[model samples]
Target: MSAMTGELAMCGASVETLFEESVEPVVELVLGGQSARVALFGATVISWRTGARDRLWMSSLSARDGSAPIRGGVPIAFPQFADQGPLTLHGFARTARWRLADRKANLDGTLVEARFVLARSAIADTQGWVGDFELRYTVRLGVRRLELELQVANLGSAPFDFTACLHTYLLLDDVRNVTLHGLSGLEYFDKVAGRDRDEVNDAIRVEAASHSSGDVLGQRAEGFVDRIYRAGGERSPLTLQHAASGETYSIAQSGFPDTIVFNPWVAGKKGTKGPDFDDDGYNHMICVEPAITREGSGPIRVSPGSTWAGTQTIQVL
Candidate 1:
């Protein structure tokens, strides 16, 4: 419930120390009956557990858990999918282990910055994608904000291409109780349906949509919401406010062209265990993804050596 105060860690087993000792920073954040463990050095949010309920986050979508073993939560994809050749699913960025490059703190102790770096390598088994790449991720935790900045560098002889996003799953008291503002007008695609390819719609607000789970827990917002928006807002940040706690978390992104929103109301979308809608697992988490490609369901190609960047900030109010 409380931090260990002005110390390098919260407890002897602080999240920071967890990484230094084990060569992996796995910190568990448990709040409102939800639990998630994130590895700072790994730059991955590994596991998410809700009380005695069950695990909703999937490390694998198919028969295997994936060659690059990421525990779950949020992952960063760089130089994206190279026409789906060697790398499948997202790409090589998340699967490879990044180096701990930087760490900084605010004068008031309200904010913290830590960075992860991924360089080009001839590892051979790295999904066959080659390019000198640098991915820098920063975490800023202030009194009111927690933000992430991803700075990428393509240092190869050729330009590298890819679509990227911070695949973050925000846990909510109830998905129905949450409202996503800032995106009302844009173009998006419906993944659930085979037809209606990338269509344009007037700005749609979250509150206006019907929650309509119509089941035991009432948390099914049926459909696949993966699209790209020309986020032309002056704020450049998307806000998510929870009515019950009066807590507002802002999901901000800049330079990224697409925002993918998905709520798996089905039993399972891609063969992963669907959160027990009966107990409210999937309904409690919302993924407001900032992506680089608006062209959904297709491979985002990167040339030989071009770099791209994006960021996401979370401010709790």
Candidate 2:
């Protein structure tokens, strides 16, 4: 939505033309008949409110700018390591420009499919950190379903080793009210335990007791959460099912090794002012992320002239 560009168009019933104008890019989405807004910088679908009658699928913050800004929902970084790589937070892929690859009709033309492709820059000699990789993102919407796919290919001459992930912050009516399915038996790190090891004795229940301690400890234990697991043993289409609305979000990934869950209810995380971040500040959004590393530690090793591919699809049920 760069202002320098021009106007945008509304292709629905209005079939109206509008300027694609905004300081930051903005994209409107109609999925499963849901009204969702995605940002240009993150390519993230932030607020998903179905038919204006249903509650927002995620939360938002009251920005000083007058936008009922969805605070904590959306996909985070890509092509960068977290806590481990020299690259900045979440990596550089989020802010880069992507092109519309294709558009086709479905749902008897009631729905549309748009594909976007991201490739390495033409000036690779200057940009050192970013890998020579191509990412294919496809977004589709129907009257009752929404689907998104991310496919990546390594294009460097040398096999590269790197960690990767799709970080999604999902809005929830209440975090404590929901139970995430499909991750019961897998081993997970109880971030509340810090550097310590603890068994998940509580049967991985939805409202299983939650805790936090100290400033650092409390940030994790109290009202906040971060968890990671290996995806080697799970079924292909992992799911995060919301019981109340009977809405199921399924995530399928290939060529990746891990998944992470994080919810920051405190200030820095809530993007608030102080330390005790109100976990539900914007609303209750949970992140079900798939990655090749946990917190950016173990990177996928690549050999020169070798190409690797990773994919994740989000489909509604």
Task: Output the number of the lDDT-best candidate.
Answer: 2
TM-score of each: 0.69, 0.72
lDDT of 1 by residue, 186-297 (tens): 4455443422333333323232133333432333434324334434223367777777777666677776666777665443333233332233345566677776643543
Minimum summed lDDT over a 10-residue window in model 2 is located at 8-17
Candidate models: Cα lDDT each: 0.52, 0.53
lDDT per residue for candidate 2 within 1-317, as digits (tens), equals 33211111233411111235433454555533554454544455445455444323344332212132223444545666455566655665555555555555442435555566767772223235746677667655555445556666677775656666666666666666666666656666656456533324332333323443546554434555666676632545666667677777666666666777666545335543333234444236567776776542367765655555555555565
Clashes of each: 15, 25
Model 2: runs farther than 4 Å from truth?
Answer: 1-21, 29-32, 35-37, 49-71, 107-111, 122-127, 196-208, 212-220, 232-248, 267-279, 294-297, 301-308
Which residue segments of model 1 deviate by more than 4 Å? 1-15, 19-24, 27-42, 46-72, 81-86, 122-124, 194-224, 230-235, 269-279, 294-307
Number of the top TM-score candidate: 2
